[model samples]
Target: MQAFEAFMDDLERVIRSAGDSGRGVLVGGDFNTRSPTWDPAVSNRRGELLERWAASCGVSLHNDGCTATCVRAQGSSVVDLTWSTPSLTPTVQQWRVLTERETLSDHLYITYEIRGPRRVKSGDGGGHARWNWRKFNAECFRESLDTCLAWGPTGEDQTTLAGLAAWVERTMTQACDAAAPRARTKSSNQEPRRLTRDRRAASGPHHDIEAEYRASKRRLRDSIKAAKAKAWEDLVGSVESNPWGIPYKLVLGRLRTASRGLTENLDSETLGRLLTALFPRGEGSVPVSQEDRSWNEG
Candidate 1:
């Protein structure tokens, strides 16, 4: 349609502007169009035109492969999709369509796996070398002594005196050895503070890990609550009993507690396994409950 074409042109302009402003663009919605260019069987002149426009703007369309045929004539189409710029493509590691049975919508829902950027270590560079008296000969030392004497007796004078004493001691030690060679020592002043490098020691690792683990568990609990809310909405649509909802919430809570315990103990493998078991993909499979004997046995 002419209106749809105009709307898409406006959207592309907005996306281009956003990309110019350094924000990665990701657009997803039911565009209500499909084309043979994208899928041989699907036919829509508007979709083909839109796809061309998207390609021109350096956008790639992500199709989840859900079609009306796949849903057994459920009137669902794979028109729901996503498009993103090149910069955002790397962050989207995986994208797939979830099951359609859980919700009232005929079209299958989608999920994306996005990975964050890697962290780099700080404070790795060439620094100033340690100071040594070997670089100064007898004449240089005499000149330094004269310079120190010229300063009036005060805090600055005392500081200069300390430096001169250290220089004399170093030169004497160097002269005492028959085969003494110039060597460099790492300066104590250059070392980073212990607290900065190892923050867990100042704040006990156990306490920090426990606090973070608790926060993570709380977040997971909230996600489970959100899932339950979705389930409740579905139940209301179907006019079904809410008996199973409470058990789902309880299981999610228990899983969160278990995950928190595992993370605090630094058992990453166990935590990963727990997560996989909780979100297992299959037909008629419920989330693993804390009361399950198998979970405890593992």
Candidate 2:
């Protein structure tokens, strides 16, 4: 019993390590011992060790195979049992004992119904299948102007057209004003006066301001490009990870074919409008000011 207990401890350690390695494990065998606490007649010292080991490893000794009395042979009690990690407890939907002859061993064959993680299916749909853009794009000021010019003849119609034209112009001006960058205020009316040659020599020559500005712009552009690339890579990785269990290359082919057919039927301007509506500019606007304070202030 002492030797058996030592062996069970080593076995439990191995099982625990295997389970901790992120893999599902099923460790089942005849340990030739029954819990003395449960059934005094058949229980032994080895049963105590097994129970302790099972508790430490969070293992469940499923009683689907053997009966309590089966520990003593002859009448043939259900002594065979199965054990598994705690994480796999929910997956054990059902357990059954098979015929002894089927297993070719003294113990009956135990079958486990394991429920693994579900696979994603591509057919799952219903979210926005198509997007629209133009609806959210600024109204066409140029188109409005053209419409006003085309309208003619009646004085009443002309007056209405002129009024619309004035409104469109104001809207266009406002849009331009919003898009333009704010002007920097001048620090002083006159530039700092140069000191005498010896005094001025103390300060180094003025830095190449234009060159630095150009370099900074280049760095910003590179950073933007790199960020965009990284974002695209991450998107691709996410799609690959949860692939919906469908061939992506085949889906891409189908999408391309469908797009080709759509290109002929859909107007370029209308498609652009749809895309604009799908991802409208200024959709996530930041507060222009907080308490009328500059953006730099908290």
| Local accuracy of candidate 1 as per-residue lDDT tens digits, 189-281 | 345565466665657868788889999999999999999999978756553466456555664664354344536886788878888898786
Q: What is the lDDT for 235 in model 2? A: 62
Give the alpha-carbon lDDT of every model.
0.58, 0.53
Residue 1 of model 1, lDDT score: 84
What TM-score does each of the candidates earn? 0.39, 0.35
lDDT of 2 by residue, 1-298 (tens): 6677778778866765664344445777766666743334466666777777776666655564333323224545444567766445435556766553354445666666876423223332322112123232344334333322322122332257775565455334433222232232232222343435545665454446656778999999999999999987876776668775334654565434534576468899998998889767783754465686656555
Model 2 ranges with Cα > 4 A deviation: 36-41, 65-73, 99-105, 120-298
Residue 12, candidate 1: alpha-carbon lDDT = 79
Predicted structure 2: clash tally? 12
What lDDT would candidate 1 get against the real structure? 0.58
Q: What is the number of backbone collisions in each predicted candidate, taken in the order shown?
A: 0, 12
For candidate 1, list the clashing residue pairs, or say none: none
Instruction: In angstroms, give how far residue 279 of model 1 lies from its true place.
Output: 68
For model 1 the local lDDT of residue 161 reads 78
